[model samples]
Target: MHGSTPIRASRTLKKSHANFYRAFHDYFVTHLPSSSLHPDSRSSSGPHHQLPRSASKPHTPGEGPSPAPLLGGTRDTTVVRIPLRSAKHHFGVSVSRGTRPYNEDTYQAGVIEVPAFAKPRPLNLTRAPANSPLEAYRAKQREEQEKDSGDGEGTSAESASGDPQVFYFGVFDGHGGSECSDYLRETLHETIEETARKYDLVSTLKGKPQTAAIVSSSSSKEAAKDTAGSATEPAKGSMPEPSISKASTLQNNLLNSWKTTVGGYFRRFKPTAFASPPETPTTSTVLTHAFLQEDLSFLLAQLRLSTHDTDPVRSDAPLNANDSLYSPTHFPSSDPQVKKSFKGGSTASIALLSTPTPTPFWHPSTPSTLYTAHCGDTRILLSRVSDGAAVPLTTNHHPSTPSESERLRRWAASFVTDSFGEERMSGLANTRAFGDMSSKRMGVSAEPEIRRIDLNPSEYAFMVLVSDGVTGSVGDQEIVDLVKESKTPEIGAREVVGFANEVSVEGDNATALVVRLGGWERRSEGGGGGMGTREAREWRKREAVDPRGRMT
Candidate 1:
């Protein structure tokens, strides 16, 4: 604070305020109608899209010519969601997390990737006509694919069973270490499953359960270990799973019930599931695929050990316990028994598409769930086709949020300084993350602000979820217009990524993943969460096509 001259300091403060304005620019957006669609996004290779808003209505599922849903699959307790567009598809992502190296006041470096998700959708992907720019463009796909085909490849069917066709895919950007990222990638589904199996019973608690309570008061003392605010809580793995209340688990139960309900739909109405003559769609339609990205980088501690720390948070665990992401050559451990430490962590935002089952009728040709997490600012900036205009779908968990600040206040009562207390950084080094345990002691949390959106006609068109890397300088509503004004989702992603990079200062790892889903039948009574009349008719049309969401 002392090194700045008066004029320089004034300018610095001005830029900081301006940056914050860029970070949160909603009031500036002009209200627009939903009918207008930007033409540039579709103008093959037209400079990356950059607009503030567009009034585009959600695409009606079956009524118009549209792409299929970008993702599909089963919904149950075992599902974990991330939003990471694949490499080949027209997907892009942007990431800018962490305090600046010299200026901890702002984000330094960031990463941005295009066409965030290369998901399989209902559209046809037969080499875009002939002589198109894409056909003319060249990349070393052959060599890359061959190289990536080996073991330990970033993508393998290690956990995939039956088909690797993802129903949903997401990105995990880690800051402190890859341990947390790896943990989520490997066990998110299991965690979801466990949460579902154990948590569903609570939802059914409105009535007496068919079985006696396994987690009773007799086990309350035992339950102390797994409780939310346990002072002497064990590490994640060591913590016994006696069970507790949380949203993730709630989602698990809801999914399980739906599965049971659907299974019954076929069993009770065997004619539909086991018809004799079988059924065929009246028309022919094609399918395509999409993909998203994830952030699995060197950890801070690992960086520290190797000139950077090898590992930071020391915990006795099974996998990758000591597989330090960064190298810590010096510095003390933030937590004892570990290598060096870091001041902060990273967050990963991914949006993936996949097929959960073989049933047809869904739009994605697959099902997709949006996965947005924050560690070091690689985020998925998505605006829902709400009432045709863009409505923010993801919540940025920052220090300024009231509830978040409250949680920290309670967590950091004894540790507060005169200024910069836990309360001061609610959205600042706040709760929920992909990394940053250092912030966690001040109660840096890891509760992701996740949502499962079954693309529907009502919530039509696709969305663009950029990171602070993109949105930081750009206002949220401004981003809405950029995509809305664009002609295609692909172009929109590229355009935004470019603009974000230009505005970004030094030390920013800016990455962007843009996902434009084709045809989404918002969950109606049958496949969607609830049935809207428009959504219902859309489903009926798909039933005319696939039946389950697709044709058997």
Candidate 2:
């Protein structure tokens, strides 16, 4: 009787939700601003908005069945161009608890605006002697700027490529408990921004060109290398001089100083665990520090909370009501049964989008770039616009991988294959993750593998980040096909998660986060279903499950 009550309640809630959404959709259409309305809708003045002619008009007997409506059953292709990072409509997220008792997965999608690191003044080397290497380098730099400007190749600092906006999307899949994933969803991005700001400030103070305007592409790396190389090489039309190497040494010192500053920031948090930061820091280094540092901090916090040996109340002492020691929530537990249940681990898949400036209404001046930092088996895939093909942005970190096995050997840890033929390191499938303090000492790392992709709108349509629940049941190409054929990102995300849950035999929690990119809505001449043939076959053979987790 109790089980039936929940089932009945679920049906009622589903019906109510459907009615609410229908009413909301009607109200939104009636209240939409004229400027925001479709060209077809603008002609109608009444609160009752007219459907597109294709959907409203009856098909004539011989009119070739009339034109079918676009993907979402309307001809309106008008999309508001907001900052991609903060635009809720442009991003879609869906999660299903599946057959799990409770969900341990967490996700985050948002923008980080780094105003402090947006702009930096150019270093002034004019005061140096004419014969000095610094003066020669400055002259050559000015010459290159003139050449670029004259060739109409100058890039504006105010362009999207130079914008201090960072779009962050992350999925954390937890095992054992949700505490570790929850902690990361709350703190990781903020830590990254703080570290980046400090890195930029120190770079400026040490006379190294700041990275604010150059974080867009590999071009930034080339620019920085050129700047450093100029210090050692003789400037064009300048004779070889003894001071060139001296200037180069000065540049190296400047690089070290900035690295030192970043290192100091991490040391303040975990002085013993993080004794040294990378000498040459980049985007990858920043992600690595944030992941490892946060993991250590989280483990320490869990240890303190779970290993409490102090008495909750002292009979001899008069306790104030305001004191946490007297409160049930904060009172320490002296029970010997208190175990380290909070030492759960979570996989992290993070993507940072550096968008290119859109000019003349939706046409980008340059291609956008994506940087992904990932650990464990959570996957990040890019769907190409040309043929709707899947492009992998991260490889899974499993104990079965050759590189992972070798690394485990070095750390005195090895994968153990169970009777079921599943390879595990310290009883965990993934070799790297955010927590699992016990497994951490046995070579379970929190270090993420970083990857960069240059997203050309003509080639790439969208990107999806999915936890292992979805990846385990669905193929990469199948995921791309599902999102590609959907009407909108929200529907696409839901379909991805729903399909995973439907086909999954184990019924693990499933999550999908889809971010629409420059090439969104542009379909290929060839259709989509061809790539997802295998998944389609599997789906057909499986018993269909209803939304409420019952066989249909």
Q: Quick one: best TM-score, which candidate?
A: 2
lDDT (10s digit) by residue, model 1, range 260-331: 432322122111111122111000000000000111122334344444333344333334344322222222
lDDT digits (tens) for residues 311-387 of candidate 2: 45433345353233344233333221223347578999998765322121112323555667788999999877666
**Clash-forming residue pairs, model 2:** none
Model 2 CA deviation exceeding 4 Å by range: 1-89, 114-164, 201-280, 309-341, 358-366, 526-552
Task: Report the Cα lDDT for residue 549, model 2.
Answer: 40
lDDT of each: 0.34, 0.56
How many collisions per candidate? 163, 0
